[model samples]
Target: MLRSRVAAAGGCVAALGLAAALAAGAPASATDRTDPNDRYTAEEIHHFLEGFYGNHGPRPWEREHLVSDRLKERIAQTPGYDLLLCAQNEPRDIEVGEVTTAQSARVGWATITTHWSQSPRTAAFTAYVDLDGSRPLQLLDVDCAPGD
Candidate 1:
């Protein structure tokens, strides 16, 4: 699926000085995990997806580390694409666009399209979160591309 693959090669490093250049460079209190208001917001989803798709690291307050091992391995073996000025350079600045949520007997999730890269590259994600408020947000799936 597109979502799963989004976590794949987006994390690779490149040739020449590009790799080193790309290698360069938050939070609230809460044991209130049980609090009803402690639901997963787009902020949390974007933070998680940032790591999953952009090859970025996890943000603070994230409960689990979710980078896929296969993705990591692929990134290591393949040359990373350095063309994403917005995606690779200032990934954190990328914003979450539209967000919608749903649940089934099996799972609950939020479907989102993020402003991800610059003018073109964008991402769609289905991130699952615990509505019962016992756990933190997780990316059930994610897909990214260069245009609409």
Candidate 2:
């Protein structure tokens, strides 16, 4: 009877441990993008921007999906500089700052800080993101500011 009780206790402890592990490993609610109808959370927007700036070389076509058609047209019209990075040369590293929801329910803004290896200066930009319902989150525009 003692052996059976000990075995049962061990199983209970193992089950509790598994449950805790699963909970810890689970993705946050804000990061879940399964439903398109739901408004994009600040965390989601931050994650998207991080992935965008983290990539090397020229921006990929797939990454453009997150940008609106209007913004794409504007980018094409502009020449000599990268509107996204707001610089002629790509930075060695990028740091995406806090994302906050704007006055509009479907809009949010994030600060993107760029660090260059060749220069001591760092640039910052405010990225405007649109979270229209039933559609994937899209970047509307970026407010570029001079480097410090």
Candidate 3:
């Protein structure tokens, strides 16, 4: 399960017009696209993220990304220490929409529309992931406009 905070280098661009406030990283190939389901399958990915968000149930790619000692400590000590956590803990149902590829063949973003189960208003966000065969699939970034 993925547990690290996303800080992209080149920035993550969302088709929904939300620029992911992440570390801007390598330029993504526009021509290279793959089905997110080919790796983790859409159903599995949806279930995984839902499981992770509700009640801090499961952590995604928690082991593969913890290459350094500091990262390990960070997760162990502060699971709810960042925006990602704040978003995850929202009192809303995480509704997964379309899943599309981004930077690499194995990496893509999921369109999620969310609102409290009791509320009528809804906001949308994209949750990016890395599902390469070399490592377990993980949630790379969770960018949401809480009020949008």
lDDT per residue for candidate 2 within 1-148, as digits (tens), equals 9999999999999999879978889654533563345677778788877876773322766347767788788889779988877888878888889999753567888888888776787778888888654566677888887434
Query: If scored against the real structure, what TM-score would every candidate get?
Result: 0.34, 0.69, 0.46
lDDT of each: 0.41, 0.75, 0.51
Per-candidate count of clashing residue pairs (backbone under 3 Å): 1, 0, 16
How big is the positional error of residue 41 in model 3, measured in Å on the Cα after superposition?
4.3
List of clashing residue pairs for candidate 2: none
**Candidate 3 TM-score over all chains jointly:** 0.46
- Write model 1 residue lDDT over 1-148, tens digit each, in one string: 8866765545442343455655642133554333345555444444545554443323433323453344335334435532222223334333344444443322344344445344665554344433433454444433334333
* Candidate 3 colliding pairs, count: 16
Instruction: Please list the residue runs of candidate 3 whose C-alpha ends up more than 4 Å from where it truly belongs after superposition.
Output: 1-44, 54-82, 85-89, 102-105, 145-148
Q: How far does residue 102 in candidate 2 sit from its true spot (Å)?
A: 2.4
lDDT for 122 (candidate 1): 54
User: Which stretches of model 1 miss by more than 4 angstroms?
Assistant: 1-92, 105-132, 146-148
Off by over 4 Å in 2: 1-37, 55-58, 103-105, 146-148
- Reference-based TM-score, model 1: 0.34
Q: 1 or 3, which is superior by lDDT?
A: 3
Each model's RMSD to truth, in Å?
20.0, 6.3, 18.3
